[model samples]
Target: MNSMQNYLADTVKSIPPSGIRRFFDLVTQTKGVISLGVGEPDFVTPWHIREACFYALEKGYTMYTSNSGLLELREEIANYMKKKIGVEYSPQREILITIGVSEAVDLALRALLNPGDEVLVPEPSFVSYAPGTVLAYGKAVSVPTYFEDEYRLKPEVLEKYITPRSKILILAYPNNPTGGIMEKEDLEKLRDLIIKNDLIVISDEIYAELTYNGGHVSIASLPGMRDRTIVLNGFSKAYAMTGWRIGYACGHPDIIAAMTKIHQYTIMCAPIMSQMAAIEALRHGESEMRRMVDDYNNRRKIILSGFKEIGLDCFEPKGAFYAFPSIKISGMSSEEFCEKLLMEEKVAVVPGNAFGANGEGHIRCCYAASIKNIEIAIERMGNFLARHRKG
Candidate 1:
């Protein structure tokens, strides 16, 4: 048998690979490419947080903790949520510490879905949810979000896509790529639909600290919804600790228990040192997060204003570092825009179509990049738009 088409699980073969990684690979191959493609924070992990990991190692905390994770880290995660998000979860039963938000998403989806069940996924979201849904033997029902509504999820939008087979709703806010956020009022609009239809929500709030307009509101915090929402957040975005790979999922005891089983078998636990560092990060990383948020906000303004100046209609991103600007003037598809930008300007931005079909006609730029690069990209974008001026 040819190794070129050796045996592979259908689940692995069925899923499309991440578009972000594709662009990342392309950017890596070409020299002098300044990437605005990556969604990760450019900041280094805080010194104290880094120090905690070293201390943990020194103390020989290299061994695994409990199967779920360290009690201390889970307790800290509980306290962090209670203090900041106005929600409380018991560290023992309600939370399962995970490798990262990525792992939490994977495990949560796998735990909740059965064959042919459907999950309603909001589009222009992070790349993982839809594929993960399919991998769980479920259908991913993508609901197109509108820039006109600021990408908010209204109940009518839900109603149109709802069917008897629908089981879970994967919601990401302070969303990746598009940066859409749903305030309390916006979330309340979906409360009845979610309740009446009995849909479970996997709320991914990885960028909770970066909200510019108002406080981040969890749908789980809304009335009667806490029991059904599996809230996922982590130390990665807030503490600039993506490499640490520590995240937690808090939800119904049944779901948490199911996830813990998967964790026990496949991963055992998150790294011991990372768990130690995660506790300290929750306790002390707030000020560092604030500074990062303020800097990102400044960069956000520069990019959004530049988009307007270049005549692209961009939804005002409320939370995450990405700005998804509509590429109306370039007379090009999102992929075309991105490829041309990288080749001609040596500046790399992710194509919107990579996120979903709903992302066509747009491109996502991460304001987490340096101000100098942001300015240069903006200047180059202006020149790029000028070449294909519609009027």
Candidate 2:
């Protein structure tokens, strides 16, 4: 058995299990725990969207879609991109439906990376970016973003990380963990650096619809960035279709073709019913999605206020359904703070460092739960803080 362990890939062996999943597993074992840990939406997929999937099932639409996905779904995605981001794509050639945004990210990394190529990933962002880069045999270099900068990746900060071998940059706006967003002007600031460096951008815009402070901007929408940016989005967050696992990637035809080659061999296509439901989501699910966003915005306000009242410093999250509050008053590392809170208060949240090193001394509290749970969790967290706070 010990010798057989050597057969495992070194890259796979190096990566640790997801920190988020580790806490989630612990929560499942504990009783009476109110979880604010996972990044999933609390709302169910709207009835109409579910109905569409049911209709597809009744119509016997169960089979592998074209490796690129159903043309109709691709067309809907094209229309969605044009309307939302002011960018147009050839659905037939530039879009490849993926299992989820997770799969899209993986595909983009695998298709674009050469061994030892560097991928510049902004920290306090998603947990998967760095590991995914590693799995693709690429180097993951962290570019730390701070709360003082509203967690936006600044041009100067980014430029310092670029090297001759830095082939890709992963941008996740309406970001996870910290809930930071990069507005149009912010993206424009990075445009020149990206162009000069000749880097391909994998823009993960899964939370675009959840932006509250202003409209979400795609780096791809900026002049000269279209062909070089691979846009990944899906029905998971906005449409509350997490279990459905439908996502798509849009980029230059050559890149899309390359990604599709891997995707066909590996994933083949997203579920046919999910594709049908996503079409309904793009066409008529807007009102429901907006309703959910409005509710999350309300929760966002409550959670921020709750943190303030508890004397924790939390940055204003303009997008997404999470509030990242500093737990430094307790003088504990993020993991210690979260574990103690979960054990004592029975309130669960992910440690900030799970996202990256910059996330240390903070905790990611998802506000996607019901108002009552949010209120209760806040009170419990207050109790936990009072006991652990250092002078």
Q: What are the lDDT scores of the predictions, listed in order? A: 0.89, 0.94
Candidate no. 1 TM-score: 0.97
Question: Under the 3 Å rule for N, CA and C atoms, how many clashes does model 2 have?
Answer: 0
Write candidate 1's Cα lDDT for 1-391 as tens digits: 5585457887888888888998899899999887889887889998999999899889988897898899988888888888777888989999999999999999998898899999998888889889988888999999988898889887888799999999999889998888889988989999999999999999999999889998898899988999999999988887889898988899989999999998889999899999999888888888888998999999999999988888888988999899998886777888888888888878889999889999999999998988988898898888877886566
Off by over 4 Å in 1: 1-3
| Native-to-model Cα distance after best TM-score fit, residue 92 in candidate 2, in Å | 0.3
Cα-based TM-score, every candidate? 0.97, 0.99
lDDT leader: 2
| lDDT tens digits, residue span 1-391, model 2 | 5487788899999988898999999999999999999999999999999999999999999998999999999999999999999999999999999999999999999999999999999999888999999999999999999999999999999989999999999999999988999999999999999999999999999999999987999999999999999999999999999999999999999999999999989988888999999999999999999999999999999999999999999999988888899999999999999899999999999999999898999999999999999999999999988888899
Clashing pairs in 1: none
Against the true structure, what is every candidate's RMSD? 1.2, 0.9
In lDDT terms, how accurate is model 2?
0.94
